[model samples]
Target: MIEYVPVIESPCMSLCVMDEASGWCLGCGRTLDEIARWGQTDQADRDAVMAALPARMERLEGKAL
Candidate 1:
């Protein structure tokens, strides 16, 4: 059994924007699809996405806005 945990914090810094080559955000470390579909996603799905953050941030290559 899995316990559903609501995301207490969002990476969004009000700098919502997406890069052309990658679906990643320029401000927060999330993809446009992820942000858009967040409302409809289940806790498990959100967890899966959260688990991928490190890799996604790595792909960002330390770029800051």
Candidate 2:
């Protein structure tokens, strides 16, 4: 029997612009470290980060999360 694992989708929007003031990517609102480590993270961790993205983007864009 084979065990199957789900793949986590990257948050990249392909904008790839870095916001120097916030140190986060303008497209995905992820820090360089987060982008770097995302591929190696497990599903639970990826989910946690995904859950937080909306709030982070809202804050970065000066909107309510």
Candidate 3:
């Protein structure tokens, strides 16, 4: 049997502040919907998110977000 894992598991660090500009979690780069529904998603979904992290971080650094 194969096992699947999630790349992002709601990066909420108790800050829970919604970024009005992007609607993204303040702590984690995941969207609110992602945080709301993590356990249900499959590894593929997480992998996708993981793949986007570098670009996302780049964006963050580029814009200093």
Top-TM-score candidate index: 2
**Cα deviation in Å at residue 34, candidate 3?**
0.9
Residue 18 shift from truth in candidate 2, angstroms = 1.6
Q: Which candidate, 1 or 3, has the higher TM-score?
A: 1
Instruction: Give per-model CA RMSD.
Output: 5.6, 3.7, 5.0
- Lowest summed lDDT across 10 adjacent residues in model 1 is found at 56-65
lDDT of 3 by residue, 1-65 (tens): 88895355544567566667777655556677777667788878877876765665466456663
For residues 1-65, could you state the per-residue lDDT of candidate 1 as single tens digits? 99996655566778777866778876666887889888787778777888887777777765543
In model 3, pairs of residues that clash are none
Error of 3 at 18 (Å): 1.6
Model 1 clash number? 0
TM-score of each: 0.65, 0.76, 0.59
TM-score of 3: 0.59
Q: Look at candidate 2 and tell me the lDDT of residue 29.
A: 88
- Position 3, candidate 2: lDDT: 96
Candidate 1 has which clashing residue pairs, if any?
A: none
Q: Per-residue error at 55 for model 3, in Å?
A: 3.1
